[model samples]
Target: MDEFAFVDRSKTNAEKYVLRQKLFGTEEVMPLWVADMDIATPECVLEAITKRLAHPIVGYEIMSDSAYEAQIEWFATHHDFVMKREWLSYSPSVVASIGCAIRAFSDAEDEVIVMDPVYPPFYSQVRENNRTLVIHTLNQDEEGIYRFDLDRLSTQTSEKTKVLLLCSPHNPVGRVWSYEELSALCRWCEERGIVIISDEIHCDLVYAPHKHISTARIIPENTVMLLGPGKTFNMAGFSISTVCIPSQLLRDKFEIERKRVHWGDGAVLSHIGFEAAYREGRGWYYKLIAHLSQNAEYIDKTLSSTPIQYAKPEATYLAWLDCRALGMDDRELRKFFVKEARLGLSPGLSFGKEGSGFMRLNFAVTSQTLTEALEKLRGALQGDAYV
Candidate 1:
């Protein structure tokens, strides 16, 4: 394995080990569970944060016009989508924004639709707000690719459905939804007056041959999109997210909630990080995606040598490994890796009921780290977990 390819080693070492110890009770196990990248934030982002650290005070911050401008420019340059500054609102985190949207836009009894084996936060945000949580399970063909069953979704959604929490360039499974699929879903929601709250936080991490389309770009004005640099730049600890609302009515309602709750603002350092990443991190982002693609391919090749099997991920750094052939429940299998192999991974059951017999791995670390993890996994598979 190439040493330089393991960029995340120096930067993510401390957090990575702490997570490993927490999950598997030792630093000996390589952690590939968290969504955070093992790589350092770009040099530009690092410099900006350091420069801010030099200043003594960390005071209350109002988002600079330059910060907002950086966001607008990023979307236009990379995504080819344009937005006015007025459409943007700041939130501390996208998950928080999701809960707020559920409360402010939809009534208590209204249903919010999401795909199963989705980000776990989506499940909590819906149910915690007293809204009905409805899941639309994606169908998997013999090829192992997960595809949305629109007919099934159509049957599930009704006039009482008030929102759809969509994940584009979807999480865990890593599908950058096709234009046709997005358009059909958008039209269905638009016709029903059901608002679309797209958690497109993972929009920038799409792999080759896959394109991420903003659902609002294809649908009506009722769509609200959540985007941020936290995931793209590996700056989740900074805690900043942008909520994009196209409709004035919906925007006003969100503002009313914002005022009542007194949501916190992004840190000054976080603002600097965001500006630097959006303005100068484009090349770094491209290289990072290339590295991730190689890692995903590595997982594919490694799995073929063992009893484990998985379909290639088209987007995101996550690989969804189908461990059904091992004939163990997700919980038991996850335990086998932790106790037997000393490997930590995100269990499929955490995503949803449909995720049983599956495991999600994050290959965003260095090639060297992935190799060790895979070797350990190979050793684990030889145990009763396989039989």
Candidate 2:
């Protein structure tokens, strides 16, 4: 009955645990990598999935319109963006939609703009699809806030540039773009005839006083918004998400690619669970925000005097730690965390060149787990005396 309870995923064959040896070269470190939460999935989602199993047939079924409606309603209520049923379609995952959209919107060799230090898949999808990549680096201001320079972005594109992959409430660096920022980016992309693909999976996990504005809301006709309850309710195991394409022309193109892949209406249980997550999981979702906000603040305070520097993220559960003060190359940084700190965190260099001298820590764990991890980090730092 504890709303902030977390489950032990170590024995569950979860990727985060299973890949420790392969990723960090040791099973000794506590994994705080990967984006999914160690917090329990919402009870309402579990109950709905369990109820669906009472029927023995367990057959393939189309995702109910009501399930999509639940999402539409959630979006309107939370983000202040209303969606038409016609604009939405089922996707197995947001990354899958990004791949399909890449193929749907642009041809091989055309440029797709991706901001550096974004989710790694954003880079891979473009390369895998044979599209050229335009890397736009986001710089942090003196206040340690990550921001995109419009003037610099303007200098990076050309006629061959066809799409912009935007991570609103961006991953790794964790910035929730302001309304003025989103509006200006949309306007810039629109005038340049670029299709904006906004990935808003973390839309609902944002902290207080910081609002997540849907990019599609700014210029509906020019955006392809990828959304889902996977991150919000910790149900990524369901492999369910929705892609919203407001432009009929883009929808037709995306449909052609979607059909080619045949990522059919997802599973029946996922449909039940997705609906319950949005419609009935509000209480659990709010409690998670409080927990994550506390963790973010905790990291900010904990690392204030340490060699590592951390800026409390405006959104998402990720903590982007500045390790430049430690004065190690990326390889040493990775080694230090694995061998010295006994923590498996995401090395920032893997995100992009701009992520150098940084590491990402996932704070969506029980308070006790977070406390232990931070203590281990502090101990490691004190022992190394790297500063």
Candidate 3:
């Protein structure tokens, strides 16, 4: 496979590429802030969508049983997770499912505990629903690896706490929660009657020597697992995801909430694309991982001698860069990157207070693009012209 199959996404209404001026106050900087990749969507996915387009009329369509089966088989084969056909529910997006779960399972003013410095939506969904947003900050060791602050998490939980939104193979920090850590978290949540909404969107993007354990595999009865191909297959435009609920009672409540919002079924093309990506995307998926791993290695090797410090991510293409060594506050760090480096990156403070002095870089671009970005960064740091 040509790992450098770069697709110019500019002028196509791509949120990452087209919204630079609105998002970062300039269109000159490289856009690497969004989670999607700069690589082309797999041929298999495009082919599937093309096949579906052959139909004369694109009308209201229901999700096929085969779509659910494809997802079930993929999870069972890849993650050792056995999902029942009945356990699957269609969601427009993971965050949408999370919002529905929040409304269905908890009442207004109830508390929902989110691991701080998490995906930003975890914060917004809780507050938007009129629920009490309780943040339990994650702890980092001296080595810069992030870990669940289970001790503090336990202290934060109470009868008012109704949900725990978990990010496995977490975003930005990129810590694939270990099985032991997950087991402990499951026990803690189960004991307190807390429902766990585990977002495993990046489960398949894991690197070697660090495995991703599905939270549902450990504690299915108490967990609502959100799995999707958006991150793995770069299909976020499809706006389709699956919610796996093991307990029938919880599924029932979620269904009611979903209906309350009049969330209809997915588009016909999305269904075709979803099933094809899961069924025929394994080969492309592995090759993409290899490319990403190489990109990550390049970043690690290049940054080793610099003042910038980063914890090499075990999963996801996102790298968390610790810039405190540069002695810049969060604002200065952002300004330095945008002005000096001409690189657009996600500011660490957006994740949480703990993320201050850090930045998240998405490396899922062509090797040439990544090298150029890194060279620009290196030049800025060394007070030389960026090439």
Candidate 4:
């Protein structure tokens, strides 16, 4: 696997690499913002795409049954969740799938509940669809472990509340919800008739001692799981995701809205890549997880001496840094990282007001890149300017 070495993405159209200037107001900062990794995509995925391009002509494409079956088999083999072929549907992306579900399941002015300090799109998709965005802010302990505020959620949900957008093996704060936690949530939502759009995109990336429980496993009847190989195999550019709606009625409604929007399956190469990723990318996937775990440990050890504090992630490559001890407001904190540390990171405030004193760092880069970024950060924090 050649250690899946760092691939320079600056020359490519990768958002994390190329859009640094536009996003952070400077291209000089080391980018550790966007979720995608700096490592190369799995060889199997690349091989599949390459083989497809050998054909003479490109034409319109339809998703093949084999692709769907491959995904079904992968999930069953990996997560112990069995999926029927009929329950699956095509989505261009997880965010796109959420938008469609919001439109299909809820009406304008309907309320959609989300855990605050979540993925930014969870906020945007609800508001953009003209739905009332209800927030249940997650509570964090002194130890930095985050837990869902079920008591607050109980009060916040009402008759108008229609959907709950869940990020399992959550992003940023990275607490993979436990089975007990999921069971309670499922019971709560089931009583209120709230449908869950479980974004398990990061499920495959969970670390040791923390297990990822698919909400569908607990309550498949009311769950629509948004999954894809994009995050697991680093194929986001392909723009392919899957929506698993086990309920026949919900599936019918989602399909109607999906077709109405004219959002169809991706190109020919995307299908090939998707299947190849699920079927042949297992070995590479395990290696990537090991690499990511090492990076997380490195960050933990590096940041311990500084004012910044990080709770080792339970899942996902993103590390949420607690910058509150630095006493800088969001803007100043962002500037400090950009100008002082020369690092471009996703400002915590972008996730939600609850995220104000933190920043999300993508540690999916090569070990060499991660080490350098950490050293730069360490020097910046120790410098007299920051002191």
Candidate 5:
């Protein structure tokens, strides 16, 4: 808790930095926009970094066997999944890896399919690579739950659809996909010979009663699963990410491009953090999840009583709030909260066209922070704009 306390405080500090920089020199709102947690690094991670710092020699380092083992063992023990060292390829971050994969395997004009309202970076990667962006928006029921439309995806996939960027336990929506959904998705891509790049960064931080189904575990040969401790351990600034490609041929192809673009180095601390987090920090992770789960429940209850309604998240600290009851556009709604409520949140449209009228809130802060933000949100809803 002590370690993560600093992280939590840093969010407020970031908000202060932005708020203090106005032309009028007036301070503004608290920021809960970024997906990063307010919690500090776990004690085990801090001890590792501290020990590394004491060495006084932060030099270029090779990826360690223990680092790989740490991730391998964590998967086997926690998710009933096993990974081979041969499949492990290092990347500085997932976004870089996504770009590398597209450049390595697909042509300039090939299509990269991603679910709409996905992590916005996915959209950026596809477009930036000069590839066609094929978005198949998820279907939502009347109750506001998102459902996978396999038929829609199948109709979209073709020979030119060479890649599908899959977000397991999806962001913004916080759905821990079922085994059936994953299997069906893999089969869909497999039939079309589309490569599957599964981003499972949030797999480790899942809330209880919802199991994270790793796509590669079910269909290892065809999928490349991306996993890292950065998001799980609140170490995103460290920028350590891993790509598990079961096929050696595919791994070699990715490596050729990853090295050419220099996406495979300079995250020494993230590697150390990853090793320590997986090897020696199980207890801390358990406690962290317990606290985050409590926070999710509190938001669920708070939103239920207010005009805004949130589907209780099955995984991830992000809450997908349905603010459609207020009948406000995404931009106006976002500004209303930022100004009136004094709370900063991620606007839904930033995720995708499908995210309009919704907002994504980070609930990984302290309970006090969560309470204060919710109160402000309530006040914002009662403003004349909403009235």
Candidate 6:
């Protein structure tokens, strides 16, 4: 419990807190906008970075094979997925990999399909790359479960569409795609000759009964998986992630573009932290899931009768809140949370038009912090909250 307890980041220059005034126009609100955890990074990762400072030299260094091997073992043990070293390569972050893959596999004006209400970068990468953006809208069922419409997406596809950016155990709205859903999507993409760029950064943050299926595991040759330890270990500051391309032909194409862009191996300290995290952070990770799960439940129970509607995510620390019930527009909804609730959350409309009238709360903070945020919401709602 001590490990997961609140360690104040107010003085750490954490972006979530530092940018609160700029983003929300207030420094008094609880800054929960960013995806990184409020909990400390895994001790093993920190210790490894500290130990690496023993070396006087901090020159350019290639990542070690043991780091890749550690990740392979972790995935095999946890996700039942086996990966070959030959298929793996280094990337600074998943978003960079997406842009690289876009340039490698598609030409200007070629189409890329991105889901609505996804991580905003998925949309930006496509547009900024000069590719035609095809938005695939995801719908929520009566029970509040978000689902993709394959038939509709299939109809939306064009011959010029060369890539599909997938988010497994999706962000904002956390749905861990079932094996069957992944298989079907993979088969469809493969049939239409669309290469899938899957961002699985949140794979390890999933909750109980909802398993994160790596898109590469379903059809590796047709998939490019963006995997990293950043989200799992709360080590995004390290800025380390990798690209897993299983096909030689795809890797050749990617390598050519990668060289053109000069995307070299990452920092020395980051490499050490990456390997250590996958190698020794298992016990800490499961405990994090338990902690996050309890936080999710707390949000669920607290907001059940409030004006805002929430369905506990099957995976991810994100709480996708439906604020349409408050009868406020997107801008008003944002202001309400900032001025009334004294909390800062991500405005759903920033994700996509489909995300209108929603708010995404990061529930990865300590229970005390979460309780305070919820109480603030309840107090703001006042007479509106149902007993």
TM-score of each: 0.93, 0.98, 0.98, 0.97, 0.93, 0.97
Candidate 3, residues 262-341: lDDT per residue as tens digits?
87988889899999999999999999999999999999999998998876789999989989999998889999998899
Task: Tell me the lDDT of model 5 at 113.
Answer: 91
Q: After TM-score superposition, what is the CA distance of residue 318 in candidate 6 from its true location, in Å?
A: 0.6
Instruction: Give RMSD to native, each candidate.
Output: 2.7, 1.9, 1.2, 1.7, 2.9, 2.0
lDDT (Cα, tens digit) per residue for candidate 1, span 1-387: 442345535344456556676666666656778798877778889998898899899998888878889999999887888878888988999999999888888998899998998999999999888999889997687887788887788889878899998988788788888999899888888888888899999999887688888877897388889999988888887788899887788899988888877886667888888888899988888878877888889888988987788877888888898889888876679778787777778888889988888888888788888888887888777664421
Q: In model 5, which regions exceed 4 Å deviation?
A: 1-27, 384-387
Of 1 and 3, the candidate ranking higher by TM-score: 3
| TM-score, prediction 1 | 0.93
Task: Predict model 6's lDDT versus the native.
Answer: 0.91
Residue-level lDDT of model 4, residues 258-290, one tens digit each, is 999897777888999999999999999989999
Q: Which stretches of candidate 3 lie over 4 Å from their true place?
A: none
Error of 6 at 139 (Å): 0.6
lDDT tens digits, residue span 81-100, model 6: 99999999999988999999
The CA lDDT at 287 in model 4 is: 93
Collision pairs in model 5: 4-39, 4-40, 7-38, 8-38
Q: Write down the TM-score for model 6.
A: 0.97
Question: What ranges in model 1 sit over 4 Å off?
Answer: 1-28, 383-387
Off by over 4 Å in 4: 384-387
By summed lDDT, the worst window of 10 consecutive residues in model 1 runs over 3-12
For residues 1-387, write the lDDT of model 5, one tens digit per residue: 322353435345444235433521234666677777877778899899888888777788888988999999999998998888888877778888888888877999999998988899999999999999999898787876788798877777678989988888799888888898888888887888888888898998787778998888888878878888877888787878899999887888888887788764556777788899999989888988988888888887877878887878888889888788888887678767766777667788888998998888888888878887887777776663322
Output the number of the lDDT-best candidate.
Answer: 2
Write the residue-wise lDDT of candidate 2 on 247-324 in tens digits. 999899999999999999999999999999999999888889988999999888888889898888889999999999
lDDT for 123 (candidate 1): 95
